[model samples]
Target: MSFDSANLERAAAWLAQIARQRLTARAGQLVETDLGAFDYYEDGSWLAHLLRRHQPSGEEFGILMLALSPHICPHLLDTVIAEVRPEGGELPELGGVRAAGHRAMLPTGETAQFFFSGMNMSRRFDIEGMFLADHWFARDRILWLESVREGEPLMSGRLIVNPEIIEELVTGKIGRPAFSMDFPAEHIETAMDWDDLVLNPLTRAQIREIEHWVKHNDTLMDDWGMRKRVKPGYRALFYGPPGTGKTLTAMLLGKHTGKDVFRVDLSRVVSKYIGETEKNLSRLFDKAENKNWILFFDEADALFSKRTDVRDAHDKYANQEVAYLLQRIEGYNGLVILASNQRANIDDAFVRRLQAIIPFPMPQQEERYEIWRRTFPEQIALAGDVDWRQIAARHELTGANILNVTHFCAIEALAKQTREVDLRCLEEAIKREYVKEGRVM
Candidate 1:
């Protein structure tokens, strides 16, 4: 559903009512108030959908609104502050902190406690329960309380709503995170379909198994009552030479399954500083934990290679990073694909844990022929002299090689002001590919 301003307005009103009541109570007025009177789950809003899906308790719902208040309506609380202390001073009881960029005060955990529990010891303890490590609030990554200074009350921490949640509520869609230091994976997708992929029957069958896991893993784990016995998520190792279908297969899997594919850049993921690598990986995995994303770690051998004997601190830490990676990937609840040029490059620890190890070897002659025939679009015509079967047999080019040749030929055809690609152009393109790869014609 689209952003519903009316529902947000209603929620803001409810928050304002509660805030005013709390402020009035602090001023020696015992005003009767029923916090449950407002509809926390209004029909048709993104927040409402989340509320319905999670079904958080009344206290939990109150905390969520308090966390979301600044983003939606900052002035609402500022006005409450003005009313309570018109002389303009900090209201410690209302609990908030000033941000350099944010003009108004942002709520803290203490704010939520003050708004909901109002100094009642029992109620405050319940609010504290919601922020515990295992609570859905933190586990689902919906919201959390920021860390406080040493020895300070935990309630003093600033309340933080997940940025994705805020984006979804405001724009009615969750924004895909961009590639950065924190999130080093880039989103990848393919316009090509399964029909365009060329693989041997055995390899194709292995891929199909991965597809089955993606489609029915929840059933296997939950519906079949195997959750206790089996581990969460699927792990696969895609080993192959360059230009084989390893990466393309990953993209196609996501395309066919309707899931996002994120290729982790190992250069960015492996930090030189001790413990930094795990932190970088943790940021990536934490964001992806509930996203059901297919994480493609291309050239994964750089990170997942066999460990060496610890001769130094660096060696010890490197091995530790690999162990940490193994534990994290095993615990992930979605598909994790580690692609490398060779299977032997990966550590045995990762291999033994893999559910599937599919190889993308160099395409055989028949597969190469199919690839050549399928590379060109229907808009481009092949000259009568062009022979795909002969070329496919002679060159032994990969699917990617054929595609590169097709692209070169197509561009040449367009340059020559014609819709047709001739045998000469095709031969020249193939020669270029061979030259680029330092291979003999």
Candidate 2:
């Protein structure tokens, strides 16, 4: 028979065993069957097949069986069988007449509760539940369950695994749960490298330090127990003028480390409602924890601004939001880079907590020339008269502005139907950029 058929048959057999045990217990008679023998693999049973497929080491089969416990429970198995075979028929025979029912009959009140809590008592199968519970507390898994709001005593909550896990089981490929549901940030595709970044010696060294920290993070945090002594994360502040390479540096760090970069959109994070900002940030951090992700907070001054005096309710709540963020950042066991144009605007409390504060200074004349030289592709034809040194000296522009002028000049050359970019085109591009910025050029 097919895998599905075999799996369902095995599930039915397990449920039948549960029914027999329950009936025997209700009758107050001494059960004679060797329940321990049932744990062994039958010749053509699903456990035997799984053992062949996985070839796990000692006790792994027991763990896998425990993980499958909830699925093989009488209620869920009956529900699945009923849905599959609507035109009901007797369950496949295992041994006793008690196991011949078309559907598992629901036990009344206390007995019904016993099915979920006591079904595994004989096997002492509590390890899987304990493992999952520990992971939930460690923030490795999110638990969603129904609970009473306020002081009311509602029905007891049951652990509901997320849909991603359910999908993995159905596909027979169990893996880590993907946080697609209620994830608040967007993943950024970083396409930068060392060659694309232009900064001073100190800034470059600082960037290299950040990369090194990420590379040996596990050793420093786990092996050395630094997570317990110090903060469990690396928080760096990239501060400089607009158009300096702060954002690019953050992206390059993520690319070099092979980690996904998520630029947190402050617009979405800073909610108008009370306590909403904390909720949003908590969700983002919970989803990102242990996921090998780099959290990039660009234009961070808005979110990390200095806390104002409590003149009103807005001011008080705003400080509370900042406090919440401070706690979350400290607790995160990953990389977080916050970029801001003005470093002075950031709160002193945050600055004190940061591991590194690297300032991205505007490019000097020599650096600007390097940026211009490297900006164009080798395939692009440039006029012999295009003087990089003169242009770098004439315009007090950031690296970003220089790139804009280069692009504009190339497009201008293309419009003029020329294969070569000339000095005049470069000058015109620079002039246009200055005009856009309202500079006296």
The most accurate candidate by TM-score is 1
Off by over 4 Å in 2: 1-75, 79-113, 119-138, 142-144, 151-155, 167-181
Candidate 2 lDDT, 1-441, residue by residue in tens: 332345545645654554455443532333443333234334554345545654543323222332343544546434543555568765321111122443454222123223323334432233223333444322445233334367732222333344444444355443433335356567776556689777998999988998999899889877988877776779999999889888788778878888888888888888899999999898888777767788999999878999999999999999999999999998888899999988899999999999899998889999998998888767568889988898788788888898898788777767888778877777888888889888977
Judge candidate 1 at residue 398 and give its lDDT: 83
Model 2 TM-score is: 0.74
Q: Which residues of candidate 1, in runs, are more than 4 Å off?
A: 26-42, 87-91, 377-386, 416-425
lDDT of 2 at 229: 76
TM-scores for all predictions: 0.90, 0.74
User: Candidate 1 at 362: error in angstroms?
Assistant: 0.9
Clashes of each: 0, 0
Top lDDT prediction, candidate number: 1
